[model samples]
Target: MQAKAFDTHLFKRILKYTKPYKKRYYGVVMFAILLSVFAALRPYLLKQTVDDYIAPKDEHGLLLYISMMGIVLLLETLSQFYFVYWANWLGQDIIKDIRTKLFQHILSFRMKYFDHAPVGQLVTRSVSDIEQIARIFSQGLFMIISDILKMLVVLIFMFYMNWRLTWIVILAMPVLVYITRIFQRKMQVAFEEVRNQVANMNTFVQERVTGMKIVQLFNREAIEYEKFKDINQKHNKAWIKTILYNSIFFPIADIISSLTLGAVILYGGFHILDGDKFTTFGDLFSYTMFIGMLFNPLRQIADKFNEMQMGMIAANRVFDILDSDKDVQKDGTVIASHLKGNIRFENVVFSYNDKENVLKGINLKVNEGETIAIVGATGAGKSTIINLLNRFYEINSGAIYIDEQNINEFQMESLRQQIAIVLQDVFLFADTIHNNITLNNPNISREAVIEAAKKIGVHKFIKTLPGGYDYDVKERGVMLSSGQRQLIAFLRAYVNNPSILILDEATSSIDSYSEELIQKATEKITKNRTSIIIAHRLATIVNANKIIVMDKGQIVEEGTHQELLKREQGYYKNLYDSQFALES
Candidate 1:
């Protein structure tokens, strides 16, 4: 574990979230103070009752003193309840705001950020890490303050009662503080390791569970189990280390507490044996109870300190994400509505991680209402072009224009509103088919979704299902077949009625019947819309007005299908001949 400096900035930022609930926070503080004052008064009242009433045989005075003691206890109990209630309430409200802000920040990041980030790590940050922050308020920070205040009041009353006995107890203070500092430093490293191990385990579990089908299909279940066992073991070790530190520190604190009590009894007993007029049995008894009160909070302070450290660690992890600059730059002020869908790429260069260019000086143009097909071998920059067009990744150089205006000049939301894409690997949420289609957009009504399904020729198939549009797709649409999922995706895209539609190998993996239905849908949807089709199946795009053949990230030929076939040694011709021979 690495050493981290105390982050004053992070602490102040967390304090800012409490501004909204300051009234509740101040209520908790007040209750804590009252509870401490009442707690300190308990032992003083006992001493007074013993010396002034019980020793003199004053029954009426004893009864009155007992009644006052009972009232103090009741006030102490009521304040304790308010302290606990308001502290927890304040913690919950603060974490709710923090979680919402963290989620919104995550939603603002670009595709590149998510592409490299593990899903489970992000989940742990959003869920478990934020919970640790809540503990800081409820269990760590407020409790520590309350204990410190109680200790201070106890010390003040003890010294006033008997300064000599107070000095004996105070002699052990330096030793206890030194031991606690060492424990805190060691536990800080242990807690960090525990948090990291938790994140690793979450990542491993999430990935394995999501890919369980692959693990079973390839007979790698035993191998994956072994891997999981290793990660789980590491997680266990991290936790055990923290527990070991706690085990060592707590008993030492208890031993010191007992020794302090023993020292007080021996010193005060000698004074009584010597016939000191000021030392009374009630005073000695009260010192014993006060000693217990003093050491008990010291022990609790160690535990609460650990909690505070854990909260600080969690806050650092969360702040790292909140402070990141990986979000897509959405600075354009122009709001494009009802775009004409004319697109052009000029000398565009791009790379996923900037290591090597995936798209190199690519240039192309598609007029409004034109259907263009991009054909290429794998990794030949076909899909990269589509990604750049959607602004999923910013181009390294060059400019892209839509309707003779720079695409970067348009507001991202307004620009994306006019464009729709049906990806190669269709993703369907664990939701109803209707909600998945409309994506819960209030502007898209149920009737419009049904009409769009009808226009795409999938309405009959959807109606044939058990619940029609209301059917739950289950996780990743596992309840539906691959072809069925693709049909649902097509219906989802069609309902949006986007001016520019992109189909990236959308019909590659389905059965012939589904492919034929999708082809019909594609023809109907692309009739008056600018569509970009990237497909390996040459037959599917034979009617495209223009076909661009690419190899090694550069365009080798551009023409109609029949015209490309006439070339003696063209990339598209060879690709077409090879696939045609295999089909025959």
Candidate 2:
């Protein structure tokens, strides 16, 4: 999001999250190893059954050999089951832990991060990206280990049975390895391209759907379709390349194995005719089975290797978020219960990046129960002040104090709990109206919710709905008007009954009628609270105890509304005059 150069060290960072479940993870790996060992044993026993039990037809030998084979099969099945279950459980557990940590890390990032980053990308990283990495743990890594172990066991047994014959099979392995390596590299690049293209398609779909209304209004549906089609074609091409390489890879591996198997039968058949006891009829059958066995695992291992490489690319992205620097973190200490709601900013100089400061050296103080209104143009750092006050972003150079204590010294959660902000853009969850208002805060009683709604004049409107407070606010509150959503937001902020209240363009979206009611509600809510309001309309803050007009992050004017109107110069006068012109 910050366009921070891609750091390939993310995979190492991800391994740290597996620390908590290392014991279970190791148990799963051990299980998989045992499963592989047992899997190889079954084939070896087939050879033994043919040579010793079936051919000889000795009664005691037959019974004992059948029992041993049955036992081997039983153990293999049980071990395979546990291996799969444990590996899957370990993968799921690790992913849960990773997601929790990633969620917290994302929340702790500065708002500026969200400004530059797409919501769709973050969603993909949190959900799909982690899933891909988890697949690497459960299926990709597990298959890889099992395949290699099976190949090794088969080779070891084959050589012990007949070294000269084994050499032919072993010789083909190097060539097989070389071909597989080349195929894996090609597949990895192709799949990585496919994955990237899919992500682009995801972003496109998300943006287009969210902006569907705008697209239709401008008659750009055809254009959007074309854009999506182009991205889809790119994705299809990438997938085609991946499929083509993968299709060739397995067959090539099979052919190489076939050549080796032919050599084994030819060489071993001649040796048996030459009266070599080791190269019996049963031995020839086993040798052929072993050669065939190597092909599947070898090919599977190559496929898993390619899959794991794709997952590694995703893991790199997921871990990038997990290991990102915490732009905002909680202080270990808690806020005093008797916090007096006094706030002071001393020489705050802030910048999102190093190039230019958003907020220059500035100072301000608001005593307990004082009402301060901030007025200026859109980019006057008004919202930045609120963000800093909430400890959402740290200043580059400054000290901010809350209740006579440096704000940073108090626990961030405690400090934020003391403040309530009604933002210009309100977001309501897809839940019941009551749950939305209460927001899972244990302290927020049902009575408080009703009271807040009543005070904000949302009670009457909500009651008109089918279920009143129980009515669902559907996705993004699409079921409600902008004004209704604003009222709901106001009630939510007020339900907290915080020591400090911030109305950030709080009434900017409501109509005149709703604005009047909100103004009255704000007056009652602001009483006896440390209040900061950012207003565009001059009439909204005419009665404020003090109005601080900011221009380019600096306070250019400060006084009561009457005092600013008298001055008739600077940002406040210009804003007032512009609003006056618009109204008239």
* Top lDDT hit: 1
Stretches of candidate 1 off by over 4 Å are: 1-5
Error of 1 at 214 (Å): 1.3
Q: List lDDT for all candidates, in order.
A: 0.89, 0.81
| RMSD (Å) of each candidate, 1 decimal | 1.4, 3.1
Please provide TM-scores, in order, for all candidate models, with all chains considered together.
0.97, 0.92
On the 0 to 100 scale, the lDDT of residue 374 in model 1 is 98
- Model 2 lDDT tens row, 296-381: 78777778876677667777777666666764465648665556789898999998778988899879888899899998888889
Model 1 clashing residue pairs (backbone)? none
What is the clash count of model 2?
Answer: 0
Q: Which lDDT tens digits does candidate 1 get at residues 391-480?
A: 777888999999998988888888888889988898999999999999999999999998888887899999998899999999999989
Best by TM-score: 1
TM-score, candidate 2, is 0.92
